[model samples]
Target chain A: MKSSIQRVKAIVFDTFGTVVDWRGSIIRDLSAWGECEGVKADWAALADKWRGRYEPEKDRVRTGEIAWTNLDELHAHALDQVLAELDLEALSVDHRRHINRVWHRLEGWPDAVEGLTRIKRRYVIGPLSNGNVALLVNMAKHAGLPWDNVFSCELFRHYKPHPETYLGVCRLMYLDPAEVMMCAAHNGDLAAARAAGLKTAFIPRPTEHGPGQKTDLEPTQDWDVVANDVIELAERVGA
Target chain B: MKSSIQRVKAIVFDTFGTVVDWRGSIIRDLSAWGECEGVKADWAALADKWRGRYEPEKDRVRTGEIAWTNLDELHAHALDQVLAELDLEALSVDHRRHINRVWHRLEGWPDAVEGLTRIKRRYVIGPLSNGNVALLVNMAKHAGLPWDNVFSCELFRHYKPHPETYLGVCRLMYLDPAEVMMCAAHNGDLAAARAAGLKTAFIPRPTEHGPGQKTDLEPTQDWDVVANDVIELAERVGA
Candidate 1:
């Protein structure tokens, strides 16, 4: 814990693994869909691989190696590549579009909704993610995650780890960076936010990358708050 | 009335005079403040002039005639000009800042909260105002207005009646222009939204400009929906 909690007026969260169980939700969703479609595939592995593609694909767009496109479009592009590699040729365009939206329909962790609802009663809570605004908005509606507002790197036309993404959110919220806390499961995200003068909270989602996840098992750097879950995080912050 | 109401999935409103009674609120607030400060000033005229400064100042920023500045900064600029003109040279900077935020403490019209709450149960309801996000957020929290989100022109770096403001909101919401409705009391705003291929809903706030307020007494154009107030608008749209 750090004394920075006294200055934090709003908490901007990292959504994918921090708030929602993306890997678990996607694996379960795709496994059910694949069974119904009579397709045999390792959906879990595919989910991990899809997550893996996120950085490289975004980097390509960010560095001007590729044209600018949104996260959904980027995810769809990667989905197509994975589908081809997995020999799932029978999947229709509509089906692929539906499947890509698995990112939109992620389920919150057991404590996520309740803790977030509590936090929202006191402070502004929103997603500061690489995911586009629509993706975050739709996910909030789907998961019943109550957000005061939604912020995305898409708003700045940049991705997380980029200082613009963190600062852009602060500018929109009319808060100095120090007054906004970035709550994430990943140290890399906390590091980026900390470097940008934002208060950082690390709540390790040990199973975010599924069982056998080795990285981000604990706080890699001194963060403002480190809690086991959003509920604990909320409790720690007096939400 | 447009036959196809289904095309409009979200209704983004204009705040201040369009949604809340800015002139009435400001006159009441400033008159009380003037009494407390023992200042003899025609507060009504000053309020009108202050509101009058909103458009041209934003236009200057929008067209690059002035550098991009948030509503707070713009309001501060106008406050200085109004203060000097009114010979209120004794007002301190802190008092000026407090007075400028009078916009954030507006009382909602009788039907505003209920009607907006109803609409929020169905459509995504937000204010796409020139007011920056924090102002709108605070106002919403203060007034208990049920906004699903806050979509300010500040996010788009342009002010209302600008195509970017309307189109940028639609783009950020991941909605087609046709899927979003511009709901306002002002015809000029609806005109811009219509020009941008978005639907329009006219809610007449006849007294928005107070006594002798001549403009926008009724809908000037054949908008998609015309209602007496937000309640009527919500009922007409099946909210």
Candidate 2:
């Protein structure tokens, strides 16, 4: 472990792909729902396309093209567009509403709960994701993630890669930047946290974007700690 | 149970006296420390004096006499005045700092943990206290309070009786005011919550201020529900 890990008092995680398997969970959940409803459509391609829209939505908020919209609203609006693109307009408004909430029902990766419970024993653990407060709170309850608190971009009114999201967690928790570790699966997220002066830990989820995923399969820079999954990340950090 | 109880999807609590016995905890902890350090002082009197300073400190912030200061800072500032008044200047700065965190180390009431856990299984449960985020988080860890999330005056930048503090919890959780119930031992807090459009539950802690406690001995208004303790409150609300 890096010497900086010894100073860490809290660990904030990226939720979407790091703590929870958004891609696989959404694909599996929506596919099962569609089959049960007799609403045939290409669930996998729709899932990927919908996930692709998340960045653009965040960019609009970051660049000031749009006001601070919570992730739940962004996800709902994006789901509407993708449903139309996939010619699934036959799904009712209520159906679309429930479908968009698949993000809230996303399941944790196999090691997520065990790892978080362990790290939580030693440090303040929470989700510092771009997801809104309600979405992250619901997700934690659904997935049994033992977060000490849930920190969301909605609370800071700034998305990931923004300095406020990284620093806000430290400010609210009364810890210095170096005393808070930003643990995530995405290289971009960790790079931003590093730039914001927080310790960084990389946990690569190679199948996060599905087996064909080509990016973020390894640590792109010298993060303070790098592990194959959250469980190993906990052990490596001496949690 | 009243029909309003059925509408409550979330329950937020007051921390100091409602869930935890601050008076008892601080008096015992500080007296033990005083004995170990070969110091002599009225621990009970000091505890009462420090708590009495809390309202004036909050009044200063709420009236714009000072900027938005968090509870930890307010507590530290109050401790300075009380220490001088009681002539306890022999303690080191480091000792004072650790001593001020007794608020974070407060133990929950006998039924607090079990009651909160029961309510949590049925509805979202959290602390919507004037305490700062770090204080409440540390207190929960110390007392084993299983909150789904923690809300604080620091998050809203407003203290209790301010409509913002009462309604902020609902807004953050994406619920209507009626969907959230404010549970407290203090009648003033529940009155403010009711005025702010939230459902209210009163669980009078008659012994919170020690056996001589007089105020808030009974429900002052027709609150949505009233009970003797949190365990009864949980049952009254049909949790």
Candidate 3:
């Protein structure tokens, strides 16, 4: 265990659901904006729909069906689709932009800041998310995530589940893949990271997709570390 | 002046000789290590010689004469030349590598951390150095520079004074060039940044090249802000 802990010198995190409560944060941001504008809608449903657009849009880029676009652009494009489908076209262009910027202001999970802070004391901690650089940097500042660095798929021009995004952090940090651990709530992300020679730690964000969340509520495979939250992750990693 | 300040939303720094006293740091590191290793040489002259090798190496990369190599690799190669010239061949491979890691342990200039902290309250502050990401990240951790992000030339595969590097930060931050300011102790770096349409702040590090420093003693051009040090830069920027 001591040898295992020593092998991992840096930990790269998956940002959206792993570190930040994206669904909760975005719902709150939209609901607040709607209240200010006197615009009414099922914000929870809208939030779910907006998030539901995320992966399919990224998949377009991943499959080379479209030119490389940053997360901000992808989010904006998806926002248009959601707005049209929800009939929230009452929102002005400025309002739509303000809504799109919600991703920049995500709040961390209850355990995120403390867990990352504790682990940061022992290892280099950073976000290796599919989010773009601007999105990740602004979110880090907004959420107080205490990242030692930012490694976004925008820097690599590839999204997560791609080998480039998983291995790019190692290249940038000049560390071997095994020296960097990938910590995420999603097993698919961990599987991809593991496939790329990175160590894997799984922490179940059981409420990530709300109470009805059916998938990724627990580790599906024997990962390097399985914890209830980031604090437990730190302990298991000997941080 | 207020308009200029309001226009700038971020400030990118030149790390070596700007936020950190690289000459002083390198000289002290080499002198201490020499004493411990029972090696004797003119460490000051060695420091100067080592720094003198810096730009020429990046020039090789910039001119496409060599493949893209990070600052750490470049520094190691240059260290070998300096060791050979100074007859310090008694140093083992590990000893040489340790000496090259001096760049990662540089101390911030006396006013750097506080001034950076002050400015960071309003604007995004980060290093826009030719140093690689690993080097800049390690130095920030070592010296407590409050950078919101790290921007190294290694990210763009081009060295500064290249237009891509200065403008790359603007693209990453999703800001217009005019909205970003380049703060540096070196006039040359500021000049390149200014040429790339970035706002320029010149802070003189008169002793950067030791007591005989003959250049960058003051602003040589009509830069946007000319301050004595980073503290004054914070003041001028209204932080």
Candidate 4:
């Protein structure tokens, strides 16, 4: 019998923390910008707090408490609150715009490009991210990611962990859920993928939230495949 | 003063005959297969008849006569009708499946990949075709087209030249219609894009409908940029 791994006709990834290091990239981007602009603040703290606000901010739209908002707006809104909280409010509009777009310029993990490139030869590959379509496209161009397509929550008007998102990518491809694989660093994401009748792969991004991060250090369950990083995931998938 | 061409942040394409030589490709593929299988038929006539059915079949979904059927279903349905009309029906299941997939395996016009690759360096590029997402993705992979992403009418559940389809792509990109350029060989497609407020590029594939093709030989309107081919498109776009 063919293995379930061989059944994955396409693979969709959770981009932030899984494929790109959002925390490190954002902190680095803001710190460099601050130094250039002669602005002083705890950039790392801002990154952390802004990311902390993300779940709550995203939840508002996810639960219909707020109107559908894309990631760019969510990030910009969260950035404002985090900046005010950190006493670094009153940024120039241009500076704020640059900082918010840092998400669009997030650097992919070391193995991301090579691994995805290899896997792409066999199965269709893309980012099923909460990022808006423009953000995903810009990120792909910036990171040199050769995604077959970009799946934005904006496309479905539904956030991840919502079954709509997990299955939406499959629906667009005219694929059965069983033929799709969801790859993510976060176990919760993989759990949702499995619950939605898709296969799963866990590739831990241990430093996703920076060196002190303790969560998502390893796969919490028996995902279809567990690999050290994207490179290993590519190898395990026999690409 | 910046020309409207300079305002284009992303470019979307009409794929079938614009980016790929669908008529020649389908004819060549079916003819070669027929030769190998010792089945004789007028492959060119079949190709033309099949393409002739495309617009009407697609218009069914566009006009809401049928529920949102994707391109794959529409193509398969049309192919069956063309096959019966040409007295070439009753092929084996696998043979029929292979014939149906010729669209996904289309070869790009001679300059398509190189030109699009150059253009992509300056702006995001994708196919804004009536083809479904899977079809676009597979075509890109097969043709070595380095698209930043794939756009399909299936995503919007509306077909061209519907206003919703044109605006939906801009909406997902968070861009004003004027910031997006629609590049196509068909004058009618360009007219639709122009009316929808997108900047337009016309690159003539003079033989897109084969040697007898007369339509879209020269752009009927003063398009934003009229190029010899995609190669000239890359140059005119200043990529």
TM-score, chain A, candidate 4: 0.97
Task: Output the better candidate (1/4) by lDDT.
Answer: 4
Per residue, candidate 4 scores C-alpha lDDT tens digits across B1-239 of 13877778999999988899998888888888889998788988988898899899988976789999988889899988888997778777787778888889899999999999999999989999999888898889899999998888888888889888889888888889999999999889989998999999998888988888878889899999998988889989899
Model 1 deviation from the true structure expressed as Cα RMSD, one decimal place: 2.4
* lDDT for residue B134 in candidate 2, whole number 0-100: 90
Residues A104-184 of candidate 1 have per-residue lDDT tens digits of 889999989999988887788889998987788778877888888888778788888989999988887778999999999
**Model 4 chain B weakest 10-residue run by lDDT:** B1-10
- Please identify model 2 stretches exceeding 4 Å from their true place: none
**What is the lDDT for A38 in model 1?**
74
Q: On a 0 to 1 TM-score scale, where does candidate 4 land against the true structure?
A: 0.95
Answer with 1 or 2, whichever has the higher lDDT. 2
lDDT of 1 at B143: 75
What is the Cα-based lDDT of residue B82 in candidate 2?
91
Return the clash pairs for model 1, or none: none
RMSD in Å for candidate 4, one decimal? 1.9
Error of 1 at B42 (Å): 4.4
The CAPRI category of model 3 is medium
* TM-scores of all predicted structures: 0.93, 0.96, 0.97, 0.95
lDDT of 4 by residue, A14-91 (tens): 999999989888888878888889989988888889899989999999788889999899999998888889877788
Candidate 3 lDDT for residue A63: 91
Summarize candidate 1's per-residue lDDT along B43-131 as a digit string, tens digits: 88888888889888888887898877989889989989998998987888878988888877787888899889888777888899988
TM-score chain B for all models. 0.95, 0.98, 0.97, 0.96
